[model samples]
Target: MSRSCSFSLCAHDWSAYQLAEQLGRGVAELWPSADRGRYAVLNRLAELGYVATRQELTGKRARTIYSITPAGREALAAWLGTPPRPPSVEFEGMVRVLLADQGSLDDLRATLQQTRESALANRDMFARYAAYISATGGTFPERRHLFALANTFMIGHYDHILPWTEWAEQQIADWPDTVTPASTNEAQVRDMLAPGREVWEHDHPDGA
Candidate 1:
C-alpha cells in the first residue's frame, strides 16, 4: 500500500470544487496523477474521520463541500510530527530481470537500452524543472520544495538504475549458449491418524 498525507479545510469557508483544484495543482506539481491522486488522498482522509462533506445551495445546483473535523486537525498535527517516508517506486525493469531467460539475449539488451534512455530522459526533465525554479527567483517556497524533491528522486533513480541496466545488459551479452532447467520434485504424503482422530494433509495434486 502507498502512504499519503491528507489535509482538510472548513467546508463553510471553502468550496469543494476550488479546494479540489488547489489540491490538484499542489499535488500535481509534486507527484504524478494530480487529480486522481489528490482525490484518493481526500477519500482516505474522509475514511479516517478527518473530512466530512455537506451539500450547499448555489442558484440552480447543489454543490458538495468538505470540512475538516477537530480530529482531522489533530491527526494532521501528529502526522507532521513524524518523519515522512520516501514514496515507493515501481520499475518494470525488475520484471524483465525476473523473466530475462524467457527472451533472446538481443531482446534483453534492447530492453535494457530502452530503460537507460527513459531514465536519462527523466533526469533531464528534473534538471530542467530545477533550473526553472532557480530562474524564477525562488519566490515560492512550496514550488521550490516540490522541484527539489523531484530532482532528488530523479537523481537517485538514475544513480541506481544506470548501473543496474548496464549490469543487466552485460549479463545478457555474456550469457551462456544454453541454460538447463533445474529439476523439480513432487512427492505424496500419507498422514497417520489415531483411532478416533482424523489426519489432515494439504498438497497440490497437479504439483504446479
Candidate 2:
C-alpha cells in the first residue's frame, strides 16, 4: 500500500479489488489469492487507522472503498525518503542454464525456449500498456512521467531477454552434450567475459 502511494496519490482511493488487479499487472503479481489477500490487508490498514473505508454503491451492489488517511500519507512519505536495497535478480531460466551441466541439455534448451516465449509475451503486453498510457494518460495523468520511466525499464528488460535467450540457444545448439568440459567453446567464453574483466581490472589497478 505504501509503495502504491509512492507511485501515485490517486491510489489512495482504490478498492481492494482494484488494488489487486492493478498490483497484479503493474507490480508483483499477488500470490495465493490476490483478491482475498488485498481485502484482508485493506481491513488491517483500516483497523490501524492508516486507511478509512466507506461503502459506496455501484449500480445494485455496494462495495467498500478505501482511502488512505493522513497517517498513511505520512508513512508513505517516510518510506520514500529511505534508501532502497539493491535490485535482486531471480531468473529461473538463468539458474537452469548455470546448472545445466548437472542436468540434461534438452531441459536447458526447453527452459531457454520458454524464457524467450515468456519475454515475447511480456513485451507485447507492455507495448500495449505503454500505448494505452501514452494515448490515454492512464488513470493518473499527473504521474505519467513515473509510469513512462517504469514502462521504459520493463521494455528494455524484455528487449535484453529476447536477444540473450536467442544467443544462449545458439550456443547450446553446438554443444554435443551437457557435462564434458571438452565441449566448451573457450574463445566464446573469454569473449563473453571480456567486458566484466576489463571493468574489474580498471577499478582495481593493483589487481587486488
Candidate 3:
C-alpha cells in the first residue's frame, strides 16, 4: 500500500477517537518534551491518508476515531528500517562544566556538587521505579515487553551517570583556587583539567 504521509500515530484495529484519548494521555505525561497538539496532528495524518477517520456517536456527540490504513502501517514498517538519530541530552550540568572556568573554583565545585546530588536523587527514584516494576509485574498489563526495555535503559542510564557525576564533583573539589583568573598559562589550564583524570580513575576503577 502507498502512503502520502510518512506515518501516523494510529494503532492497528483502533479508531481515531480511541487513539486520540490514549495518545493525548501519553503526551500529557511526556509534557514538555513531547508535542501536545495530538488532535491536530492526527487530523493532519488523516488528511494525508496515513490514517482513516470514522465518526461514531456517543450519547448526543459525535467523535472522530482514527485507525491506521494498510498504507500507514506499511509506512511505519518502512520507518522502522530507517536509522535513528543520535541521542540528544539537554543537560544543564554539562553547560556548567563547559563554563566552569569563568567562576571561582569554589563556585564551580558547588555547581558540580549540585549536579551530583541531582543525579543521585534521580538514581534513587529510578531504583524505586525498578522495585515497583519488580513488585507489580502485571499492573496496567499493557506493553510490558516494550516498557521493560525503556525502563531498563532509563535505570541503567541514571546508574552510570551518578558515579560519573560523583567523579566530576570530586574533580571540581580538587581543582585549584589559583586557577580562577590568576594566570594565563598552559600549566594552569592543565592543572584544572588533567588532575581530574585521577579522580575519574578512582570513580571508575574498572575503566570502561
Candidate 4:
C-alpha cells in the first residue's frame, strides 16, 4: 500500500496507506513509513472476515485495497457505543512550562509564543478544512453532519489552546523570573475558580 493510492474512494474500498493518512491527519499519529503494525492489523481484520482485500494495479504497481465487510461495520458500531477514554495531550511546550523553574523565563516565554503560534496555525487549518467542505461538498457528503461535529470539536480544542496560551503569556509578563518568589494574584485565582465554584455551590446550596 502506498500513500499516493488515490484521491477518490470507490465505495468503501481503502488502502492501508489511505487508512494511515486518515488516522494521522484526523486524530491519531501514525507514521506511514513504519506502517508494519497497521498492515498487520488490516491483515488480521481480513482473517476475521471483518474486512476483505483485493489487489488492484495502478500503473506498474499493485496495491492492496480493503473494504469493510458487514462484520466490520458491526464491530465499528459496537466500538462507537463504548465510552472513550479522556483525551490525552502530549505537548512538549506544556512539558517545558511544567519545568519552567529549571529554565530561564525567556525559555518559558518562547515556548508559550510557539504554542500560541501553533494553535493559530491549527485554527486556520480547521477553518480552511471547513470552508473546503462547504465549497466542494466534502469527500463524503452523506457524512457531512458527522464531519461538522468532528470539525467543531477540533476547532474548540484549538480555540481553548489559543486563549490559554494568551493568558499564560500575560501572567508571565508580570513575573520577574521563573524562580523568584512572587505573590499570587488572588483575583486571577478567584476568577479561574469561579465557574467550578458556581457549579458546586449550585449543587450544594448553603453547605447542605
Query: Among these predicted structures, which one has the highest TM-score?
Result: 2
Q: Which parts of model 1 have CA positions greater than 4 angstroms off?
A: 1-41, 47-49, 52-70, 80-89, 137-150, 176-208
* Candidate 4: tens digits of C-alpha lDDT, residues 1-104: 22212112323577877776654454431123333464567777777777778999989999998887777766766766899757667677889988998989
The C-alpha TM-scores of every prediction are 0.53, 0.85, 0.57, 0.77
Against the reference, the lDDT scores of all candidates come to: 0.59, 0.74, 0.59, 0.71
lDDT of 2 by residue, 1-208 (tens): 4455323323647766777667666565112233245546666667777787789999999997778788877877787789985766657778888888888889989999999998898888788889998899987777779878988888998899999998888876878777764446778778778989999999999999
Worst lDDT run of 10 residues, candidate 1, spans: 183-192
Question: Against the true structure, whose lDDT is highest?
Answer: 2
RMSD to true structure for each model, in Å: 13.4, 3.1, 7.1, 4.9
> Which residue ranges in model 2 land beyond 4 Å of their true spot?
5-12, 29-37, 182-184
Better of 1 and 4 by lDDT: 4
lDDT of 3: 0.59
Candidate 3: tens digits of C-alpha lDDT, residues 1-208? 1221222243343454444444433222223243345446666666767777778878998876667777777778887789965777767777877776676677777777787777677666656655766778633345556556756776676677777767766544544663544354557457767768888989999997
Residue 201 displacement in candidate 2 (angstroms) = 2.2
Native-referenced Cα lDDT, model 1: 0.59
Q: Give the residue spans of candidate 3 off by over 4 A.
A: 1-40, 53-65, 103-142, 174-208
Worst 10 residues of 4 by lDDT: 1-10
- Residue pairs with colliding backbones in model 4 are none
